[model samples]
Target chain A: MISLNLVLFISSLMFFIGVAGVLIRRNLLIILMSIELMLNAANLNLIAFARQSGTVDGQAFALLVMGFAAAEVAVGLALAVALYRRKDTVQADDINLLNG
Target chain B: MNALFTSIGHNLFLVFGLLACAGAAVMILSTSAVHSVLGFLFSMIMVAACFLCLSAEFLGMAQLLVYAGGIVVLFLFVVMLVELTKYKEKSLFTTQIKWSFPLVLIALGIFAYTMKSNLFDAATPVALSLSSGLAEGLSVSAQNAQMVSRGLFAGFLLPLEILSVILLVALVGALVLAKSERVS
Candidate 1:
């Protein structure tokens, strides 16, 4: 009962939005935000399970996720910056010049 | 524990959750970089507060500090640095409309399957005796810190150390990419 049906529904909703974003967004910045959104959804699950299990491990894993998210942002933004500088645009379609 | 009070609190979390879910979708859907960043900010704060409600105080602080204080600002700065105003020519939506419906359908399918299969199967569902557990966990603070330290050092030393290498690689990759390379 600690993990309510409503919370699970919310989790799924956030996750579904993230998936939609990654699928449909043309902007790299938006894609990265979708990834972050997905991570947030997972983090919510972690906290919920943590409370349900009466242990700190789930919370601990969630903290580790926060650290990973920081690293992910650092790397992702740097990629976005590099791509922007070179392509002069951040559109995802612009980078497909290698197609044979 | 009454019905009215429970409904009200549930309504509050629902509002916050809706803010986050809708904001994240808008963040991706918006062409304006500033609006996207703002949307992400809204979602991050809502998630942090949800963590607090889940009784993971430490994780909540981590989410707030690392996400809202650090990454969201970093995102805004990146947005500004790119000077998106300079590029008035590019269209907002992707050219690949053919892929959107199928791709989103697949992703949602996978997400739904995982949510049901993995979570339902793996959820341990331990009964929460919060009052008893909190009393014990609080009384043994010094002892708990020792255990936490040992766990961090022993079990998590690899990730703690490898993160530095990852950062270094990212930094070098950025510098190398920014160099005057040939554009095909």
Candidate 2:
């Protein structure tokens, strides 16, 4: 069996990479993908701890997270499509309409 | 032969976990949107494999089916739909790259420190005993799907129903948002 600490370490690395991607990337789609990466990293932690503590709640919550991810992607991609249609660009830096 | 297989089994988490991390890195660093989606697909699959390593068979399959099969295809369609060629020559990263890197490093440093402090180690035994009592028939030896189903239905039924409603709302919202305005 893998140690919980090691799994936690891997998840943290993935989460931070996702954070970096969100902060550094200019494209909206990639940012959405980075969010997915972060969610997956959290799911990994949930499953790891679930296994460590011998319960099914973590897996159930992970399923909920997956459902949430799907919904988020659907809405996010739609927004991206809408943005591209109106602005002719998907770059995050370009969408400054709300800036006041 | 038995020892070799056991060793491989023992190290499965390490192998798939690292592969997942590498895939996330690739997704973040890749220049093309298509490449980024592919990298995300790879990372999702590896994470699913890690779930399998942890014996969560149902969650692993869900990850593969939903994330790899559904989400990546959606991303690919959007990538193809949007005009990516014009932006190809432009820089992929934003101006925040300089500061973001250091901030992320600091966040990771805090995470490492917390781990090194062994906060979870002390809580593990208590969690284990409590869960073992709460999980009457949902033992590790039970079928993964069965255990998960029982847990969801028995404990998480309300959330499951609420999630369905949320999915419905998202579907409607997506349709509304992506719909092209009809010419008057």
Candidate 3:
């Protein structure tokens, strides 16, 4: 059987990559993509631990996270579209209208 | 043959991990928003595979269904209709890389330390055999799907219903956001 460490390592690496993207990327779409990446990474950790514990709660929670992610992505992308239509550019810097 | 068979599981794990990492990297690095969406799909598929390897059968299937089937389709449709041609390479990666590196490193350091040793200790032989948690007298072995349904729809029924409500709200919000602005 494969060691659990490998699974954790993979998930953590993906999480970091996602974090890096969210921090460094400018395009709104890519930032949304990175957020999905983060969510997926969290799901990976849950499922892995669930496997370790032999409980289904972790997997079930992961499933719930998937549902939440679906809804979040839908709303986020739609807002991006609304903003894009109004402003003609999806650059992150120009989206500072809420800046105080 | 036993050794070879055992080794196959590790191979599958490696394959899934690599696919996930590569897909996530591609998703993050792609210049085009459309390509980024596709990259997310690929990486998510890999994660589903990893879930399967970890015995999270229900999660694996749900990941494919909700994320792959639903979210990516929504993202692609929006990207196709939106004026994504204006998305240029120069603006894709900002000058924020300087700060991102340290933050990522710190997070990774803390996460890695916890995940490494903690999981190792948790994987002690006793924790591996979970014959007690599911049911005592019932002879039926708890499959991943069965245990999950019992846990979520039973123990977590309340949160499940709340999630449905949240999803409904998100649907309404998306519609509201997409509503045509008043023509002055």
lDDT of 1: 0.73
Candidate 1 ranges beyond 4 A from true positions: A1-4, B1-6, B86-89, B102-154, B171-184
Worst lDDT 10-window in candidate 3 chain B: B122-131
User: How many pairs in model 3 have backbone atoms within 3 A of each other, for residues 3 or more apart or on separate chains, i.e. clashes?
Assistant: 0
True C-alpha contacts between chains kept, each model in order: 0.45, 0.77, 0.74
Question: Which candidate number would show the highest TM-score if scored against the true structure?
Answer: 2
Query: Candidate 1: which pairs clash?
Result: none
Cα lDDT, model 3, residue B145: 61
What is the C-alpha local distance difference test score of each model?
Answer: 0.73, 0.88, 0.80
Q: Give the TM-score of candidate 2.
A: 0.92
Q: Write the per-residue lDDT of candidate 2 for residues B1-184, one digit (tens) a residue.
A: 9999898777988889899989999999998888889899999999999988888889999999998889999999999999889998889899978899999999999999988887456344212222454457554464778778777887899999999999999999999999999999
lDDT of 2 by residue, A1-100 (tens): 4678888899999999999999999999999999999999999999887877766788899999999999999999999999999989999998898887
lDDT of 1 by residue, B54-80 (tens): 655666777888899998998898888
Instruction: Kindly list the interface RMSD, in angstroms, of each predicted candidate in the order they appear.
Output: 3.6, 2.5, 2.2
Q: Which of candidates 1 and 2 reaches a greater DockQ?
A: 2
> Residue B167 of model 1: what lDDT?
66
Candidate 1: clashing residue pairs, number: 0
lDDT of 3 by residue, A36-73 (tens): 98898889888777766655567778888888988898
Best by lDDT: 2
